[model samples]
Target: MSFLQRYKAGIGLGLYAVGIVIGLLFAILVVWADFEAYDFQAGLSVEQKTKGFSCPLAITSNESGLMTAEISNNSTRDANATVRMMHTLGSALVVNQVEQRLTFSPGQTHKLSWPIQASDAAWDRFIMARIYVVGSMPPRSTADYCGILLINSPFFTGQQILVFTLALALVFVVVGWRMWFVSNKQPAIDAEKSSRLMIAFAALVALNIFLSINSEWLASGPLLIVNLLLAVAVLANRLNKSTFS
Candidate 1:
């Protein structure tokens, strides 16, 4: 059995290799892409609100080690609305900064969580969290807000994840070079002559892995290159079989 056969590997290894490479690279990018993650909304409502009405909310940091905020629309009026949050890092907006629309319906109740960083840690710490509504006709009602801030999790994985980033970069380097014409073996023989496609596909696969691993990270271009290689490998295998059969 050849080395690949010993590993029970064929086209699958290409996919796995691409995955690992992308994951590692993504973790590295996440170390810097810590954008407070408040960009994605969790709630949206379509009601109108009155200026004087306020809502009551309870925010807390639980054993799960996440900062959570819970909002309840305690108003007589139907509050068709959209929700988002904003937090200042270090008590000022000049440094670490983040703001977002909340992800909740006027009649909906949900929580939002974030990894603690240089900015406002979470809803738990804030006594009164504020939210904005998009709809013109918001319910004339009261909303409540409360949040928790956990002193950065004791089991935070940032350090370990960062350590894995180096490996990802190395693999991406291989994929990148391969795509750039360092090797005669074209990853994408399926599309006639497509070295560039292989590279692109490799890069995307790497990016997917990066996101999976980082859970906190975003992809740099290197990850995309790695996944592109994986795609190329898959494409190449299919082409070889068709030619022989």
Candidate 2:
């Protein structure tokens, strides 16, 4: 009989260990991507206030590189607002200007938007959009606002992608060798113990699926702990003595 046929339980445990390690890697990637997205948001939001508009300002960017700003008017009269975009690195502006004009009624919330051809390299700099309220609208009613937007890029850089892929390949190769070759030396576990290990493995599989789908709710540290525990369980089962009695 083949070694796999003689040691089915050991084979299952080895397979489960490989799956657990892979799952851990995926969890790490998810957490890293989440932090990267947060950094982009923090870098792109402009907080400087212009003179003449007192209302709060919020800014967002779309996939097509369009930036939108929602400005609230606190004044009793309507006013025209001129919005302009600037890319700044350090103290100097780096790119061409884009501007738009919009009118906001008293106590009205106005959404101003404009499209731009922002390059991925632009993300390394600060891109800000300023709104200047024209006419007699004093800074007390509607303060001028500067909002920022950033260009989107891939979650992983070229070097990070290359390194991560190599690490994953190495893990797979090591785990594959252990599962197919080393497992042949392990004793055959009884059906009851095998069933119990399989049940635990299945539960972890389900948990991993849930975590992948709803990763935002839980921190990655906890996810990593769970994966480590799963690895321990599978490795323990792989080394357990086989006794039919």
Candidate 3:
């Protein structure tokens, strides 16, 4: 195919390939810089907490437990940052801890140390804590700490990977509808079809952006819903080809 012809047939594919490369590069950079640091306090997970907020984790067995987390800098940029922690304690036992804020710098390290003590009731509860960025809380309830999404199921995470599949399905629908089934009475069918594709593509794009920015808030179930429903839909349509014939 000529250059223009090839572009016409494959622009979407080309854009998708480019997007994948960029996303991979970003993820890799994060993994590389953070490989040695267990600094959970310096990440988006911690940045999602509200200001003047207090969340502490109840650590029962602090056999001289010292947790060190890396203050992550994705690039040459140095960000102004602070961290707060929250931990849940059992009803019988109370926890004694304090919230402290510290300046986080690039190419440097910050240390967090707290003493966790149990009451006479014997702390035996599974405690969970929330580490938040100072004044970095998300306005949406759907957003977990710092818009970080929790993926409990492999099925849901799979939805993120197969995201473009739905858009492709929608594309085929429009193409088939236009070529064979659109009402010619609608003189604007071509433009309407193109507009609709653009809109669908825009929605897909928005889904992706939201999926990226607020992805940390999404659970695996939503992914499964989108994937399975689309899969069954495509299968049904395929099996009904003879009916259309």
Candidate 4:
């Protein structure tokens, strides 16, 4: 086959692979954005009044599921606020640690974000988030605040999940068809041609590896899968050439 014909046939497969990866990422981001934040009022009860800390506002998560707190200092002086996000599962404690720290001046409202990653598996079990705050008071005293923080599940609607599954299935179907069924048999390639094809395949493998490092889905399963498909394609092509040469 001429170079032009080879390009024409390969372009569709390449596009499908790239499309599936990009589409999957876009869908996750969209779903996360839709259900990212939860507002929890803190220090409102009479119990909090005795402690001298105030202004419990909101807690939110970013697209990556990092937690953040929107709080205002109601005290008369600057205070150091330490916020913690604790994960609990059905009367069992799973995770509890400090999430963010911020210094707030009197009446200052600030949004402090922490790198708290909530795994997808957290949804399968009962999960609850509690935000705790410890603030510095005058005369070396410390005040404490605690409240429940609610974060909605990203996959609750399930639309994005369905879309991703369909797109992934389509990608597999197209790539499988080209690799196992579609014939690319030709006369035996010279050493130079074989080397070039090997180099191209190596480049594809490297690209997939790089992408997988940045994507959990690809790193976990899809990268190895597609590489296996590519290997089978190459082996089948070579076997056909050797047989018919």
Which candidate tops TM-score?
A: 2
Q: Output the number of the lDDT-best candidate.
A: 2
Residues 201-222 of candidate 1: C-alpha lDDT, one tens digit per residue: 5466555655544332334435
- lDDT of each residue in 126-150, candidate 3, tens digit only: 3323344442222211111221111
| 1-245 per-residue lDDT for model 2 (tens digits) | 46555575356445645655565555554443333333331233333444332211111222234445666666899876655544333222344455566677898776656554334223442343334333334443222322232323445333344346446644653454445443444345644454555455545544653454333414544755776776676566545734322
What's model 3's lDDT at 84? Answer: 50
- The lDDT for every candidate, in the order shown, is 0.41, 0.45, 0.35, 0.44
| lDDT head-to-head 2 vs 3, winner | 2
Q: Which stretches of candidate 3 lie over 4 Å from their true place?
A: 1-48, 51-130, 133-202, 216-224, 242-244
Which consecutive 10 residues in model 2 have the weakest lDDT in total? Answer: 53-62
Q: Estimate each model's TM-score.
A: 0.30, 0.36, 0.28, 0.29
Per-residue lDDT of candidate 4, residues 87-144 (tens digit): 4332333454456677888878776554433332133322234456556743232323
How far residue 181's Cα lies from its native spot in candidate 1, in Å, is 5.1
| Deviation from native of the Cα of residue 235 in model 3, angstroms | 4.2
